[model samples]
Target: MQRKVLVIEDSAVSMNLVTRLVQQAKLMPICAATLTEAKHLFSQSNPEEFLCAVVDYHLPDAPHGEAIDYAIASFVPTIVITGRLDEETRTHVLSKEVVDYIPKENTQVYDYLSRLLARMEKNKHIGVLVVDHMRSSRTSMASLLRRHNFETFEASSAQEGLDILHQRDNVQLIVTDFKVPDMNGTQFVAELRKSWPKEQLAIIGVSSGNSALLSARFIKSGANDFLQKPYCHEEFLVRIMQNVEYIENVETIRRAANSDYLTGLPNRRHFFYSVNHVARTSPALQSVALIDLDHFKRVNDQFGHDAGDKVLKEVAKLIANHFSDHNVSRFGGEEFCLYFANVAAEEVDKSLESFRRAVRERPIRHQQQDIPISASIGVTHQGRKNLDAMLAKADELLYRAKSSGRNQLQSDLLA
Candidate 1:
């Protein structure tokens, strides 16, 4: 179900903007011009359906952030937007358990709000670890993280933090205090760095101690960022968001490098890397198949390159769904590859034949036209040999399959 965002704004222009932003984040926006209307709308629905509420600070019905309080009391995360840029107002808004507040002084703040909404939705899946010897400190930090929709894990010591990380693979960020029974913050960070690199995991060192050198020490020990003690809520959230985004941006780039631009399947280089890793296990039975789409060029010539691309994508989707348990890749234009491990030759042959029939039976629909497509596959069931050698045999067989006729399977076993 699409989650809802409760947008309580009195200004016509602002309400329109917030509603559009909520929709852009793939959320449904429930709008009300006043707090009373918001209450009536919210009462009619479940609070769990709301991702968060974007409330204007000075709603005519509740001018002093009463709506913010009401939303928080009702267990809905609230974000305050105000034209009041005074520090007093900022402090008052932050004092409440709201997610965060934005000053509606410029259009840029709305952009920030958009990003914040997106992060809140994404944070539901991202786990954050909080490590501190003091129970109060750990709870304080974890509570703040939870308010933003992050799955939070609490650890009282560095060792406990490490253990939690070992058990949970989804943890992406760690906030650690300098004082711990097992190790100092810098030592703990260094220990974590030995296993988790900066790109894969982010660690932020926070200290309330008066030592000025602590930040440098933590950074030198491989912490991604450092925060001083008694940090403001905004500063704390900003630091956490920056570190998390850094890790996420690196991951995005890594995935783009490994994926095919058109079909969104694993590319050839990634295929080789993955298959070689599996090959190192030396399975008793292994097979490699190279698949080439038959008459693929004719599709492009008859229709256009766009239709040809669509056909490739449709075939790629079928390959992914049919051979989900096997490693599959789209080797550049009109060709794909599959690696099967520990499967009998007969089973591999059966699977390939089934896949071939699936392709021949399904016509790709593009631009209101049905475009027929088929694949010629070459299989090599040479067990536990050089992957390149297997691929070479498969490619040779593939040539033969194309040579004899199209839409057929040729294998070295048959040869």
Candidate 2:
């Protein structure tokens, strides 16, 4: 189901703009022009159906933020927009635990809104670690991160932070203070680099000392960025978002390079690299399978390349589902490769037989036509041979399977 976002703005122009922004983020917008309508809509929604909400501080029915209060009471993550910039207004809106307050300056309002939405969407899954021996500092930073929807973990000292890293591998960002009980911020960053690189994890150092050397030291020690103590909330958020964005972009590009664009399976290049890595790391016997679709050329000849693509996708899905735990890849057109690491010898044949039966029994439907697909598979188990030799043996057996009959399994071990 598409996620929905509630927008409560009295001004027609602002409401229209907010709706467009929500649509651009690919979220369904439930727009309310007044406080009464907003409450009615909230009453109608399922608690889990709405992702978040945006509310204007002044509405037709409730001018003093009643709409924002209602949203907060309903447990919705709210973003408030207000024309007022007084301290009292800011304090009141923030006290309600609305995600953040956006000023109605009209110059950068929508830009900040879009960024917040994007951050909230990604933040729910990204884990952040705060390392500071001072309870006050750690609590303050963790509270801010939590308000932004980031999953937070706290560590009192550098050693504790390292232990937390081992326990929670998904930690993507670390905010550490220079005055930790154990190692200082710079030293902690250096130690962390031994396991996590800049692309895999981002570190930001915060220091109360105004010395220029502090920032320089942290940056030189592999920290992605640094923060001065007593920084404004906006500045801190921007720095965190920027570093996290960089990591996300690098990861996305890496995945694109390693994955097949059409079927989202590992591409041929990644397949070779992973197989060798697994062979070197795993001691248990590994099995390699080379599978080729039998007479796949006929699908394109009969139904065109588009239909052939559909069939290949369906076949890939079948293979992935049948061998969900193994490393499976698209080894170029009409061919795929599978690597089963640390598996028993007998389990290899059993798995392949099940996959073959699934392929033969199920036909892909393209344009209301059922197109049957079958594959020839060959398996080889690692003995004293290397990965390259095992793959060669598998390919050799695959050729024999095709030569004997189109849709069959052939392995030297089975003989």
Candidate 3:
């Protein structure tokens, strides 16, 4: 079901702007011009259907943030927007348990709100760990994190935090205090850096001491960021978001570097790295297969390169779906590779035959034309020796398959 965002505003200009932003975020906008109308609309709808409520701080019917109170009371997260940038208004908005407030002074704040909406949706899958010796501190931090839809974990000691991290693989951020029974904040961060690189896990050190060097020490020890105690709600949330985004941005770059630009499959370098990692375990049986599209250059010669690219993409999709359990990759051009561990020779041969038949039967549609395609596969199921030897052997068999017949599976297994 599509989640809805309840937008209550009196100004025509602001209402239109907020509505567009909500739609751009891929959320349904439920608009109300007045507090009474908002209440009527909300009473008829399910509260669980709403992702959040964006309310005007000064409404015609309910001035002085009464609409904000109503939205919070209705169990929906509230975000306030107003032209008033005064200290009093900011304090009043912050006093309420609202998610965050946006100043309507410029267009840039609306962009921030858009990012906040996206983060709220994504945070549901991200886990955050809060480590503090005091239960009250841990609970307070966890409560604020929960409001943003983050899955939160609480640990009272450094050792407990490490244990929780080992058990839960989804944790991406850690917020720890400087004082703990087992280790201080800098020491704890140093210990964590031994295994978790900054690109994979984000850590923020918090301290209330008067020392000016605490933040620097934490950073030197591999913490991504630092927060001083008595930090405001907005500042704290911004720091957390920045660190999480840093790790996410690194991951995006790494994936682009490792994936094929044409088909979005793993490139040859990544394929070699993955197979070698698995080879260390030395399974009882292993198989390698090299697949090549038969007469692929003919398609590009008859149809344009665009049509040929479409065909390759379609075949890549089929390979992904067919061999989801095995390690699969697209070695440049029309060739692909697959690695199977711990599978018998007979079963491997049967799987390859099935895949060959599938490729021959399915025709790719391109430019209103049906482009027929087929693949020749060569498979070797010898015991583990080395990846290079197996790949060379598979290549020799692949040459034989293409020589004898175009669309066929040739394997060393006798059947």
Candidate 4:
């Protein structure tokens, strides 16, 4: 499910700022100006309504702990923001279920909220322990991760690294270099892998000079990957991301399993996912356009399936070109669908007309003849209806377009 964020602030400016920040964090946001309104919104929503919430300590309706308590009860990770976070209130605030207490106008508020969002994503705290016996190396690595917004811990030796790993379950990745005195890198990673096994923590080994044999040994010892030392800034960042991004990509592709293979366009599964995601995330009005190629069966009949595939590829490219800014997907077979964010149905008509003109001007070149094609697009705007219902309406209009005239665009907007 997509993570939703609730920003409960009475000040419109502060509310707007927090909303933008939450959106930038890639979470859905629902704004509530008062505690009563927030409660009203919360009661009618599902249990997964939100992942986290940003709530001001003082609200227009309820200034005390009621709103925050309500949020906590609803299982949303809460961040309490106020201008009155002195030592006394800070202690009391931390005692509550709130994630962090922040001073609203402070420039560091961004950092505070960003870190809170990261921690909430983990469903817990963020901690990275650097394992190097050398005082300078330990300090440098830990300081770097900390500067990049990670909470870091340092372990001075292999034994110390083991101790920190035992306690810090949230340690996502470790950057440890070879050449630690006493027990070297090989022994350290070997012991780490042995203990953790499948849920073993991520490891990135570091070595300087020609450590090809050393890298092989480390990989055998269960390190996920390694980077040679004396690496520049870009190399360091890229290596870090290479090791980290795989986890995210796996999760995204797992979610995107329904995507089609032929044209790399989203299939029915991705279409619904995007539709639901866009519905939850976009605040502006929107419309959907269902597109189908005119006389699609004749193309398939005259030119074998190979030629049909080429036409589909070309159509996919055209759809991508015209609907680049929208949520365009292949709804199986020859049908293409788009959810134009913040665009009205009337606007979709103009957009579809331009698309038709472009595709007709370009030829598919089947059988050495300039085989021209046109599309009939049907558009319908958002309504108090589900995606299924809206699709039915769009499908009806698409039939109208096909029957009335093969090359014309028809819309179900208003009358």
Clashes of 4: 1
Model 3 lDDT at residue 116: 85
Alpha carbon deviation, residue 341, candidate 4 (Å): 2.4
| lDDT by residue for model 3 (309-346), tens | 99889899998998888899999899999999998889
lDDT of each: 0.93, 0.88, 0.92, 0.74
Ranking by lDDT: 1, 3, 2, 4
Ranking by TM-score: 1, 3, 2, 4
The C-alpha RMSD of each candidate to the native structure, in angstroms, is: 1.4, 2.3, 1.9, 19.0
Question: Model 2's lDDT to the true fold?
Answer: 0.88
Give the higher-lDDT candidate: 1 or 2: 1
Candidate 1 pairs with clashing backbones: none
Which residues of candidate 1, in runs, are more than 4 Å off? none
Regions of model 3 farther than 4 Å from truth: 301-306, 366-369, 383-385
Query: In every candidate, how many clashes are there?
Result: 0, 0, 0, 1
Q: Candidate 1, residues 1-415: lDDT per residue as tens digits?
A: 8999999999999999999999999999999999999999999998889999999999999999999999999999999999899999999999999899899899998998898889998999999999999999999999899989999999998889999999999999999999988999999999999999999999999999998999999999999999997988988887888888999999999999999999989999999999889888888889999999999999999999999999999999999999999999999889999999998888898999999999999999888899999999999998667988999999999999999997999987777
- Could you give candidate 4's per-residue lDDT for residues 50-91 as a string of tens digits? 777888888878777577888878877677887675777666
Reference-based TM-score of each model? 0.97, 0.92, 0.94, 0.45
lDDT of 2 at 215: 95
Model 1 has a clash total of 0
